[model samples]
Target: MQKEIQIAQLITALQKGDVTAFDQLYFEYAPLLYNRIFKLIKSPEIVEEILQEVFLKVWNMRAQLEVDRGLKTLLCRIADNLAIDHFRKASRDRALQEELWTSSVGFYLHTEESIFDKEKQRILNEAIQLLSPKRKEILTLCNIENKSYKEVASMLGISANTVSNLLVSAMKDIKNYIHSKYEGA
Candidate 1:
């Protein structure tokens, strides 16, 4: 259902810093993002900030953007991530925060929380960074924050259905990204 050619054109335009292209995509997608996001945060103040951050991140990374999968999905993934980060930073000092983190992240702890493990940490960070924002957020929430999908969706104002859909897509992308890099003998 995605307009593939239009999206590819938009991605190309966005990469060139085309204002019209940016405005076109932003106007079209920001509402869906805001609605999906505000359902959880419910704060116009933080929601606006995170929304801006999501678009900005998209523009910043536009050079690397690919639309074979549709730009809307990528934007959705970005929105999902910023929402999680907003929640993480917001609850950084809450009493039950660790419990929340553990539930959201996987058992991905290395020797320490520090990326000082150099090679290993770099590879790990690359993998994390390559994840569609949704997967990274899901991994963050379930493993790092220890949150359940129910809780994560509640915080983001999204249905568990949406969260599950995005998480599944993210996991598949991560697997493919990692597999392509590691598969060669």
Candidate 2:
């Protein structure tokens, strides 16, 4: 009960732009947040980054702090959200890498002996150019730039679902183009 009162006081002070109070709150809560984040992320480096981000968010949202709801709850919620974002990005990156690898392998295995590496690259580039501008940009962000659906959506100001659908469509079109170009080869 006493500790809760202290935390509440700190939160109240933080909301009033007290940097010292914020530092005190951080010192008291950072270890707990780090452990909670590490459970989800399992990487010290990334956990550290997310820990910093959580505090940064706390600072940014200081004015809106709800002291009655418990600071620990808010901190944990922010940490969890950041950790989930990391996982989502990592999962998307792995899937994209696998798709590119599979495409490259299939291209090599199915192409004729006369098709040199440069020619294969040229064919792939030609296929990419055939995409509509939006699809092309989506493909570049997802594959070439290695960005997550969320990142691409944020960049283009579109929904993540839209980014995902366009990427799937773009991949299919690229595959079809490559297949047709090498059908007899």
Candidate 3:
């Protein structure tokens, strides 16, 4: 059951410059929001910025609020959407570097198709294990499942550019891992 006097109400009070309410709201929700942002973005600095922005947004929009449910879901959605936006923007910034190295990028053709599904699965597992969960999620959502960038972004609650960035990073890591493991074997 949901509490009648919810944290959103506390947030509304905080938005009105109620210091005690703000402190109460922070104590209640900040840690959960922080971890949610951190797991996705993986940067304390960026997470701090996102956390501040989230509170600011809540405060700025508090006047128009209506809550028929628990504050947890609403707050989680806001933090998640915002963190995805931040990471997506950062990912786009990193893409210029990839474009510069485009000429240096090479594609390899596999001549040996003799490996059975079991062996292929083993190598694939190793590759997946080498990735951080975020990267693995990016690949699973976009590549293996054949979702469009926008689709993956929506599913992950981020921007298309962020999806692109995560996909790029994940691919690079997987390629390097596979090479080091199978190059001379």
Candidate 4:
């Protein structure tokens, strides 16, 4: 209750252009926002970029801040939208997609509770490995590599329909493998 009161006070001060109040709010909420973004983006660099953008937006739109809507809600919606935009951009840019995937593993180490995450990653890796080579390649290209159906079809010299079919089959295989592994647990 007291924290809520303090947050409301800070928001009111921030509306009046108080830099100290803004700093206090940022300090209190940045970690929570950062963690939320990292979970969605899985890339430290992009997460940091989005975190800064979230605050910049808050500051730029300070006049519109509504304490009733809650600052955390506003920050989260901004971060989620930015993360979705990043994915959309990445889908069109092969280089960015590759960079994000390559750097993802490093970011997991930054979190203390990554042991369970690592195990899940291992299981997913195993499931992918169990797929046929061609199916595995298609899944990696279309999903992990963030390639469009047309681009992947062109690269593989296969029809878009074939690519789609293989992708669906591969996904089912992965799903079944994961389900079987965890069914009894």
Counting clashing residue pairs in each candidate, in order, gives 24, 0, 0, 0
Which candidate wins on lDDT?
2
**Whole-model lDDT per candidate:** 0.80, 0.93, 0.78, 0.91
lDDT (10s digit) by residue, model 1, range 4-38: 77878888898888989999989889999999889
Report the lDDT tens digits of candidate 3 across residue range 1-185. Answer: 34456665675675576878766766788999999999988889989999998877767776665555556787788999998798788788789778656634532112233345556778878988889998899898777889999998888899999889988998888788778867767
TM-score of 1: 0.48
The candidate that wins on TM-score is: 2
Q: Candidate 2: worst 10 consecutive residues by lDDT?
A: 109-118
Better of 1 and 2 by lDDT: 2
Candidate 4 lDDT: 0.91
Q: What local lDDT score does residue 159 receive in model 1, on the 0 to 100 scale?
A: 85
Rank all candidate structures by their TM-score, best first, as comma-separated numbers.
2, 4, 1, 3
Which pairs of residues collide in model 2?
none
- Give the distance in Å from residue 22's predicted Cα in candidate 4 to where it truly belongs: 0.9
Q: Give candidate 4's TM-score.
A: 0.50
Q: In candidate 3, which residue ranges exceed 4 Å CA deviation?
A: 1-3, 6-12, 100-185
TM-score per prediction, in order, is: 0.48, 0.58, 0.47, 0.50
